[model samples]
Target: MTTYLKDLTQSIGYLEAQVVSLLGAKNLASMRGKGKLNMLYDP
Candidate 1:
């Protein structure tokens, strides 16, 4: 279970990075402000 969670977290981080690169920081911040982001992945 620990390994699974670690892999999942890593995957989520990678995906989030991709989204940030595609959307840019300003767009990401706007989405966060609108409460569109999940709290677990806030960082």
Candidate 2:
């Protein structure tokens, strides 16, 4: 059970990184560096 919990956390982190990279790539590709990917998170 402990191993399962650890794996779950790791998987969630990996998934979030993949999603963020994909979104950031698209944004960066379109803007060509006019804005930052982190801006998506900031208000």
Candidate 3:
């Protein structure tokens, strides 16, 4: 029972980290896209 609980907690932590990283990556991608747009539009 204790071992199972530990594994469950570990899995949840890993999932949370994965989600955070994915969000960060998406934000970074959008930022890069905006930079590209600025470069194209700016005089």
Candidate 4:
């Protein structure tokens, strides 16, 4: 029972990290897209 609980906790932490990184990647992509649009309009 104790080992199972430990494993569950670790799994949750790993999942949280994955979600954070995925969100970061999405934000980066959106920012890059906006930058490209700005460049297109500015020049």
Where does candidate 1 have its weakest 10-residue lDDT segment? 34-43
The deviation in Å at residue 40 for candidate 2 is: 15
Alpha-carbon local distance difference test for all models:
0.82, 0.85, 0.87, 0.86
Task: Between candidates 2 and 3, name the one with more favorable TM-score.
Answer: 3
Better of 1 and 2 by lDDT: 2
Per-model TM-score on C-alpha atoms: 0.55, 0.65, 0.66, 0.67
CA displacement after TM-score superposition, residue 15 of candidate 3 (Å): 1.0
Q: Which tens-of-lDDT digit does each residue in 1-43 have in candidate 2?
A: 9999999999999999999999989877776665676667656
- Cand. 1 Cα-lDDT: 0.82
Candidate No. with top lDDT = 3
* lDDT tens readout by residue for model 3, 1-43: 9999999999999999999999989877877878876656555
For candidate 2, the per-residue lDDT at 28 reads 70
Model 2 TM-score relative to the real fold: 0.65
Q: How big is the positional error of residue 5 in model 1, measured in Å on the Cα after superposition?
A: 0.1
RMSD of each: 9.8, 5.1, 6.4, 6.2
As for candidate 1, its clashing pairs are none
How does model 3 score by TM-score?
0.66
Model 3, which residues run further than 4 Å from truth? 36-43
